[model samples]
Target: MQKDIYVVGMMVDERGSKAPDVQQVITRYGDKILCRNGIPSPSRERGIITLTMEATPEDYQRMEQDLKGLKGVTVESIHFSQPESFQLCENR
Candidate 1:
């Protein structure tokens, strides 16, 4: 089976209310994550986090479900596959 790339976006409206919990869950799935970036709102009332990963369907679903359970947090994900003819110019 071909592996897929997933870009997950999380928005938390309550600042640090659930950030630690979300970070814990992300850390648990660190092996599957390729990149992670988080930015806090200037007012510190909200935060935006992005995670790029490659994981099995089961693992992906589990992660999504875990994130969705957090209060004041909204999660969204996009999945795509690289074209067979495409080639990576550098190793990750």
Candidate 2:
């Protein structure tokens, strides 16, 4: 049996961000982040980024701490999905 974990987060950039900054953040997280979407504001003073990540217990713990340390970035909300059982398929 395997455990399934999900972390959903809404991110705000207090100072706003350029395309490169958002790209860097995605690159930094790499494969741990399963999906991400961005909404650009017409005001150009704010941007919203939503992230969905597949996390292990350890990964979740680490990101919770590390996300706050991101410069010019704020985490608006974080939701941890209820634990679920998963079937593991081993081929070999």
Best by TM-score: 1
In terms of lDDT, the poorest run of 10 residues in model 1 is 81-90
For 1-92, candidate 2 gives per-residue lDDT tens digits of 22334545545565354545555656666677767777877676667777777656676566655666666566654555544554333478
Compared with the true structure, model 2 gives a TM-score of 0.59
Per-residue lDDT tens digits of candidate 1, residues 1-92?
44567899999887667778988999999998999999976678889999999777778899999999988889999987766455434688
Q: Against the correct fold, how does model 1 do in TM-score? A: 0.82
* Residue 72 displacement (Å), model 2: 3.7
lDDT of 1 at 47: 95
Q: What local lDDT does model 2 show for residue 2?
A: 28
Task: Give me the overall lDDT of model 1.
Answer: 0.85
- Cα deviation at 63, candidate 2, in Å, is 2.4
Q: What is the C-alpha lDDT of each candidate?
A: 0.85, 0.60
Full-model lDDT, candidate 2: 0.60
Our model 1 lands, by Cα RMSD against the true structure, at 2.7
- Among these predictions, the greatest lDDT belongs to 1
